[model samples]
Target: MNTIVSTYNLSKYFNGICRVNEVNLTVYEGDIYGFLGPNGAGKSTTLKMLLGLIKPTKGNMVIFSKNFNKNRQLILSQTGSLIESPSYYEHLTGLENMRILQRLRNVSNKKVQEALHIVRLEKQQNKLVKHYSLGMKQRLGIAMALINFPKLLILDEPTNGLDPNGIREIRELIKSLPQRYGITVLISTHLLSEIEQIATSVGIINDGNLLFQGSMEQLKAKNKAYISIKTQDNNLAKKILLTEGYKFKQNNDRLIFEDLTDSHIAYLNKLFIGQSIDVIRIEEHRKSLEDIFLELTGKERSL
Candidate 1:
C-alpha cells in the first residue's frame, strides 16, 4: 500500500508550552488509522497540523506523497475533515446545508446526494438540522465533509458525544468506508475499544509523545495470554508453589502465571488437590487492547 500521509518529527506549541512533541505519523492508503491517546495527549493537535487547521511549530508534513507546504491546495483538495463539533444552521434542512456546501465546494447535486447516501442520511436529508438527533447531526457533518469526495477523511473523536447505538452506527460506517469507497481514514479518539473495532492500523500517543505505531495485529500480538489460578486456600497454595520453586504473580485473590501448558495446569491442579488446597478455578486470560494501552501510556491517566 502507498503511504497516504506522513510526518517527520511533527511538533506543536501553544504559548511556549509544548502541546505535541516531536512525533511521526504514517498513514497508508485504504487504511483506517486510529490516532489514539488520552485526553489532551496531542491527538487533536497532530491531526490539526495534518489538515492545516493549525501550523506546526516545527517538522515536516507529507500527504499523498507530496510535501504539505509545497502542495497545500492540491493536497487539501483531496482531504476532508470534521473536527470536534461541526457548525451548521439549525433552521436549515440537512439537504439545504449540503446544498450550501455544494455551492462552496463547486460540486454537483449528484455528489451531494451521493455524500448523503454514503453517510446513510438520505432519508433524513430534508429534515431540519435542529430536529435531528445528535447522531444524525454528526452523520450530516460527515456527509458535508464527503461532499467533495475526498480520498482521505480525517475525523477527530467522531463518536465523542454519541450514545452506544450512535457509536455503533458510526463505527460501522467508518469500517465500511475503506472497502466501500476506497477512502483512507484517519480517526482520532481516546477510546481503545473504538479503534479495536474499526482501525486497521494504530498510532498511540501520550504526553506529547508518539509511544507506538503499527498494524492492529502487531499491537494485539503484544497482548500476552496467561493462566490465572484461584483457589480457596491461596495462602497455602502460594507457599506450596514458592517451596516448589515456581514463578508467578499474585493478585488479591488469584495466582497468575504465564508460559505454561495444559499439562502444567493439570500438574499444578493435582499438586494443589493433593496438598488439601481446593482449586476453585483455573482460567487462561488474554490482555485486552485497553489493558495494553494503559501499560504503554502508564497506569496513571491524566484525568
Candidate 2:
C-alpha cells in the first residue's frame, strides 16, 4: 500500500512545553488508521500539525509524498477534516448548510447530496440544523468534510458525546469510507474498543510520546495470554507449581501462568488432582485492547 501520509520526528511545542515530541506517524492509502491516546497525549496537537491548522515546532511532514510546508494547499485540497467539534449554522436547513459549504469548496450540488446520503442524513437533509441531534450534527460535519470528495479524512474524537446507537452509526460510517469512497482516514479517539473493531492499524501515544504503532493484528499479538488457575488450597497449588519448575504469579486466590501452553495446562491440572490440591477452575485469559491501552499509556481512564 502507498503511504498517503508520513511524518518524520514531528514535534509541536507550546510555551516551551513539548505538546508533541519527536512523533513519527504513517498512514497508508485505503487504510482506517486509529490514532489512540489518553487525554492530553498530543493526539490533537499532532493532528493540527498534519492538517496545517498549526505549525510544527520541529521536524516536518509529507502528505501524498510531497513536503507539507511547500505543498500546504495541494495537500489540504485532497484532505477533509473535522477537528474538535462540528460547527454549523443552527438556523439553516441541513441542505442549506451543505450548499454553503459546497459553494466554498466549489464542488457541485450533486456532491453535497451524495455526501448527505453517504452519512445517511439524506432523509433529514431539509431539516433545520438546530433541530438535528448531536449525533446528526456530527454526521453532518462529516458530510461537510466529504463534500469535495477528499482522498483523506482526519477526524478527531468524532464520537465524543453520542449515545451507543449513535456511536454505532458513526463507527459503521467510518469503517465503510475507505472502501466505499477510496479515502484513507486518520481518526483519533480514546475509545479502544472502537479501534479494535474497525481500525486496520493503530498508533498509541502517551504524554507526547509514541509508545506503539502497528497493524491491529500486531497490537493484539502483544496482548499476552495466561492460564489462570484457582484451587481449593492455593498454597498447596503454589507449592506444587514451584516444585514442578512452573513459572507463575499469584493473584489473590488464583495463580497466573504466563508461558503455559495447552499441554502445560492439562499436565498441571492432572498433577494438581494427583497431589490432592482440588482444582476449582482453570481458564485461559488474554488482555483486551483496553487492557493493553492502559498498560501502554499507564492511564486508568479511557480519556
C-alpha TM-scores of all predictions: 0.88, 0.92
The lowest-lDDT stretch of 10 consecutive residues in candidate 2 is 294-303
Error of 2 at 268 (Å): 2.1
> Which residue runs does candidate 2 get wrong by more than 4 Å?
231-245
Per residue, candidate 1 scores C-alpha lDDT tens digits across 1-303 of 799998999999999999999999999999999999999899988988998989999999999999999999999999999999877899999999999988888999899999999889999998999999999999999999889989999999999889999999999999988898888999999888899888999999998999999999999999989999999999999999999888999987989998988888999999999998899999999988878899999844332
228-253 in candidate 2: lDDT tens per residue? 89999999888888898988888888
lDDT of 1: 0.92
Q: Which sections of candidate 1 miss by over 4 Å?
A: 230-255, 271-281, 299-303
Task: State the TM-score for model 2.
Answer: 0.92
What's the lDDT for residue 7 in model 2? 95
